[model samples]
Target: MEHGIVTFLTDYGIDGPALARAVEERGLDGLFLTEHTHIPTSRETPWPNGPDLPRHYSHTLDPFVALGAMAAVTERITLGTAVSLILQHNPIGLAKAVASVDHIAGGRVELGVGPGWNREEMANHGIDPRTRTARMLEHIAAMRAIWENDEAEFHGRFVDFDPIWSWPKPVRVPPVLIGGEGPTVLDRVLSHGDGWMPRRAGLDEIDALAARITELQTRAADAGRGHMLVTVFGVRPDAKELAAYADAGVDGVLFTLPAEGPDTVLPLLDEWAALVA
Candidate 1:
């Protein structure tokens, strides 16, 4: 069980199976692939995490391909697209891919998604930056329908699809996580998602958000959904800070290894294992 998993999020461009084997050998609980379709050298929007955050934000193999490879080799470790460029994908295609990956991994997959902010990136994929929020919400709705229904359909301003058969339905529907921090996004998370993952929303904010989420969960009890999880992002190795989050109702702490290579990564994994051990 994931008593406390030190999950990995990386721009890893290695043999996924071999890497996963190493992780399993050293005893890690899960592997998550962080997303970045590309990094525009000339960008206007500041990086969300911070100016000093490393370039691991980009420059890596596709998360899905890498996670799929990891799934092929690992017997029990969980796999996920920690946060995919969900806005850029066709809902049907993504639903199918997620189901396929979950099947290969014996039904272990969590779809962490967000309203992507990079303007150039969204434009490259022909998605209007102005409508990203609405687009993402519709995409979420459509993806859920495809996952939960044999003959799925959606009728919305942006995602109108006729009833159609979808196959090899996931043995279990993957958890849908909404990532982004803001009141509107929080409302969306409370109403639509299965979990809330506001990555890089510093510790203080996370503590406050945790309280707000509890209030929302209490309201949702009327609708029969009070078991949503809260997961921290880019978690550091400070035990006190980590404990603060745990005290705030967080269910997981997901972090990314530095972008350099395994030398920098394996030590951190060992350190993390020691902490949770």
Candidate 2:
């Protein structure tokens, strides 16, 4: 099994280019960046982890642009968005950005997507929280059509577009990992996404997590989706925890890096490198 790291990059935090270089140099599987266009002011939606959302949510840099910068400085290491909020983006434009990044990185891109948790945030992008799941599915389908075809079009209740052209259609259609632990998420992954990224906080036990993956795999088999991989995120930086995930048949375990400058982050990265070593 492979393991990766996800980090929130900001103007005030880690050196993105340097960290990417080290990730490749150290032989880590991949480095995924987190995203948030902007955090809305309304407090209608409480933070998923706690009562108050962390400051990093508002300060996180745009993953696509940041990852593009990282791609310009390094190669070999997989660079990806841990979970892009697709429900808030224009699918066509987002597709172009994704394709551009994938082309720049020579196909080392993973498009992990989610219909975010913040109602106020979704409202800022004119996305109704209630229909976000439907919109997200349509958004992904539309992006796929754009990625795999010269002349593409997608018609759905949430996303309806006529024939259009998008250039630099990725070196390869990047693998998509759907993020969330909703009741219908497995179905969505089997339908459109190439993998599933479930946060560790959502599953109560490793045994249960393994059971869920077994069920997903069985369902995927029934649906003729044999390539549906599993990557568990927000995992503790403990070897025992990682070993349990590996035993659970998780394809990858994503560790969260602290939001800090290189002086702080590099040492942490080195620590992680040694842990994996």
Candidate 3:
């Protein structure tokens, strides 16, 4: 299975170019950055992982800009978003940014997208959290139209546009990986995504996760969509667990890295590199 790293590239963490270079030099297959445009200070929406939000949530650098910098410094590693919050950005503008970065990266871009968890954050973007799934899907469809056609147009409940011209189409349409572990996520993946990216909760969840992957693939095959890639996000560098995932037909695993400086981060990269090797 392909091994990769995922991290929140915060203002205080190891910078993108350096981190990308380190990942590539150590023979990792990909480097994926997390995204959070900004955090709402209301503190009303509870964090999914814990009581307090990590410092990186508000401090993250823009994923596309960081990925662009990473692209300039690296040659072989895939550059991607772990999960870009799709409902927060204008589809046309987001499409342009992704395509421009994909062009700069020579098509080495994978866009993992999700309807994010923060209610206040969505509210700040004028998005109703209840309708976010539909909006996210529409955003993706609109972006796909923009990427695939010379004069693209889309008419949807959330996104509507007359035929319009956009420049520097991606070297290819970057594969859209649907991100989330919700029960309905597989349905979304089969309908709109090139791949499925689910966060593995723990080593204990591997068997159940494998069964879900099988179900996803079988359903895709039945629908005539061949081989949906399954990438487990937030994995740890555990050999036995990785082998189990490989046996279960996962295409890739992205291990999480803490938002830390080189002294703390580089050694962990070395440890992960040993596993990759």
Candidate 4:
């Protein structure tokens, strides 16, 4: 299985170029950055992970810009967004940004996308949280149209645009990984995404995750789509657990690094790299 790292690249954390170089030097396969455009001060939407929202959520550097910086200093490691908030951005601009980064990375870019969880944040973006899923779908479709065509036009409930030109199309269409573990996530992965990126609940959930992978692959085969990739996010560095994931057909596992400077982060990377080796 592919071993990678995912972290919220924040202003307070290790900078992009240094972190990317460290990850590559350690022989990690990929480095994925998390995104949060801005955090609303209302604190209305409870954070899923804990009672208090983490500082990194509000301090994250823009993923595309950071990834671009990372790409300039790294040669082999893949760069990606762990889950870009699709409903919060304009698709045309995002497409160009992603494609530009892909060019900088020499085609090593993956886009993991989802409808985000912060209700107030979405509201601030003029997005209705209830309609976020539908909006996310439309945004991705519109972005894909822009990426794949010289002159692209899209007319949908959320995204509508006339045929226009956008330059630096991705070295290739970056693989779209649908991020969510909801009941309907598989359907979205099959229909619109190139892969399934779900968070690991715990070791106990491995069996169920395996079952879901089987279901997704079976459905994909029936639909004539082959080999759906499954990458678990926020994975702990446990050898037995990783073995179980590989046996269960997970394509990759991303270990999360806390948003900290090299003093705290680099040692962990070395440990995880040793584990991977």
lDDT by residue (tens digit), candidate 3, 169-255: 999999999999888999999988999999875768888888999999999999999899888899979888889889888999999
| lDDT string, candidate 2, 121-226, tens digits | 8888887889988898899999999999999999999888999999999999989999988787888888889999998843348888888899889988887767
**Where does candidate 1 clash, by residue pair?**
none
* CA RMSD, predictions in order: 2.6, 1.5, 0.9, 0.8
Query: Model 3: which ten-residue window has the lowest total lDDT?
Result: 200-209
lDDT of 2: 0.86
The positional error of residue 227 in candidate 2, measured at the CA in angstroms, is 2.5
C-alpha lDDT of residue 128 in model 1: 86
C-alpha lDDT of candidate 1 relative to the true structure? 0.73
Candidate 3: what lDDT? Answer: 0.92
Please give the range of 10 consecutive residues that has the lowest summed lDDT in model 2.
200-209
What TM-score does model 4 achieve against the real structure?
A: 0.98
What is the Cα-based lDDT of residue 18 in candidate 2? 82
Model 2 earns a TM-score of: 0.96
| Model 1 TM-score (2 dp) | 0.89
Position 32, candidate 3: lDDT: 94
Off by more than 4 A, model 1: 1-14, 49-55, 200-206
User: Which prediction has the highest lDDT against the true structure?
Assistant: 4
Model 2 spans > 4 angstroms off: 201-204
